[model samples]
Target: MSEGLKRDYQLCEEIGRGRFGTVFRCFSPESGEFFACKSIDKRLLLDSIDRECLDKEAKIMQLVSGNPNVIQIIDVYEDDSYLHMVMDLCDSSDLYDRVSKRIFSETEAAAVMSPLMEAIEHCHRHGVAHRDIKPDNILFDGRNRLKLSDFGSADCFSDGRSMRGIVGTPYYVAPEVISGRDYNEKVDVWSAGVILYIMLAGIPPFYGESAADIFEAVLRANLRFPTRIFHSVSPAAKDLLRRMLCKDVSRRFSVEQVLRHPWITSGAEGRRDQ
Candidate 1:
């Protein structure tokens, strides 16, 4: 325990766990503030190749944390066995938990999505791709501001250079990625579309009991909006979903285009007027 950390902060219980690290709820006695410290195992990243990936994730988070939709990484500490990142802690739970309780209206979903799309747009603008955009990584702060976390699968890429290697959760992977074709950050938009689908429907757009079945369904690229479940959804909402979920990446609406989308703009205007 003596070598577990530096002296500034005291570690609390574990808040979450991921393949790379365990996140802890920590408190700084001097600042009297709570922060999340993700302790990434240095042993797992001993390989030069794996080390580069984790290093890149930290840089990307540092580069884009200033954005409103993304969580802040306040500081970093490293020891022989671990690399610890001190980050903003969101206590309101994840977006998945919120939606699990009830289906969100188009307006409600739009409000939550507006800032997220901004964050994604900001990341793309900065040449970063957050391959994982599942609901579990999206959290809400005390003020209800949605913050995007978990950039472990994130990458930084050159413009127009195809980012090879399919990375992302199976159910949310873009079709182009599944086809083993060269892909870019547009893949994140597709994942966001999947999130929107789950937010409104309380279920995934594509699903199967087995991993193979899920992959086949994703590869099939058929989106089902059963009237029974979607009858109450609006045309504008469905239109955005259609374009965002378009199988063809070329035909998919870019993040900027999505921001201008009526579904998003209308909700923004509503929120402003209220």
Candidate 2:
């Protein structure tokens, strides 16, 4: 740890690792509280683009800090060799881990997804788009409240303009992203829909043996709710999924629209609004 960081917090054991940094549990003497510190080695940032991504992650986290469903970055420190970010410590398992351990009923899945949609809506309202919205990015704090983390692949967008690049995990990636076309915030809705599918079905809506095959499936955008697996799933839930996983971006449900859907509004109780 750098001298400035050492003076501020006592770094403890390693808890996680990401593409460019290692996350450690740290203690802040000033507040007598624990936080997760992501220490990114300066050497790994080889170009301006790399440095910009790091800066963007910090700014995006700050941009959406007010949302309770989103992780808040408390402080940031830089030194000769590393960039350190201190943020909320979510020691519990991520959404992926929890879902993998058990199957979720429609109601249970809705309970988990409501706050996540709120988090995504919060990000969208702030003109930010989380390019990556995978299960691993969804975390739970000590209180078990859902908190969305990992802004490394997030970016800001404006109306009438679009973002370029295919940036997302294969299973949850939006079809528009795979098509190499300029996409907007709706891509996130597609990913969130995938999460909903996985939560209820215990499997991804799209599948393949390899990344390429998965990409092909995503490009095909043939969404189906297997009767065997989805027989017990609600029609309202399936309807929402069809709207969310729609290949036509114009027809896909927006985050706000999703929040207001009957399935969502009814608390996903396997019933639709009258």
Candidate 3:
């Protein structure tokens, strides 16, 4: 709100833009550290309920800070026209950028997935569900370490309470979410499974021509694994994917279960990046 605060940050340039807001690369004169400043327009928040959602996101980030695998929210300030959030600067591109380039090897995939799984496990332990666990939300740090970002769609889970509202990217939405059924942390596991499938196979198991079609496919479609992509993909990986992506929320594996899966534990030793 004060010019002192504004003057402290040297706005470098725009690094990314998305539906919610624009992210600017900035430097703090006091600490001499770089950060990403995400500015959300108050005007846009007026028309939508996302203002409260954004506030929730800020709180979630504050709760999750100090976890090495999660992005750190350094500061939060709001003015009459905008809400500004300062976060740790991650120079490496997102998983989406990497996946678009080519299918990642099992080693590379495991390298990324290890930290990601840890971060999700941390969130679950703290009663938070990311609700949106897609490639785009998985960012890479300057050291190439994977850090989960964008808590805009995250929600806290209390026992027996179901979140009402359609959230998350279309392709990553869980079956329960699509069916308007009561759901919880398991929904995040489903979305993570979809992400795993993409990382290993280079494509989503479900597809459709429209949003409605995608919703239908997510609800009723059987997950298909492409055996042709990687001849060496183990049965353990396929089985883990099946367990995570199961349409029945009750049947889906928990974050802890998924982390202990053979593909994740046994393969951890052999799967580090070269």
Please give the CA lDDT of all the candidate structures: 0.84, 0.91, 0.83
Expressed as tens digits, the lDDT of each residue in 34-142 for candidate 2 is 9999999978898999999999899889989999999999989998889999999999899989888977878878988899999999999999999899899999999
At residue 256, candidate 3 shows an lDDT of 91
* TM-score between candidate 2 and the true structure: 0.96
lDDT of 1 by residue, 107-139 (tens): 788988888899999999988888888888899
Which consecutive 10 residues in model 2 have the weakest lDDT in total? 265-274
Highest lDDT: give the candidate number.
2
Worst 10 contiguous positions by lDDT, candidate 3: 265-274
- TM-score, candidate 1, is 0.91
lDDT (10s digit) by residue, model 3, range 10-113: 77899989786789998998998899998887777755467788889999999878888999998887877778888989988889999988876776777777
Ranking by TM-score: 2, 3, 1
- What TM-score fits each model? 0.91, 0.96, 0.92
Q: How many backbone clashes does candidate 3 have?
A: 0
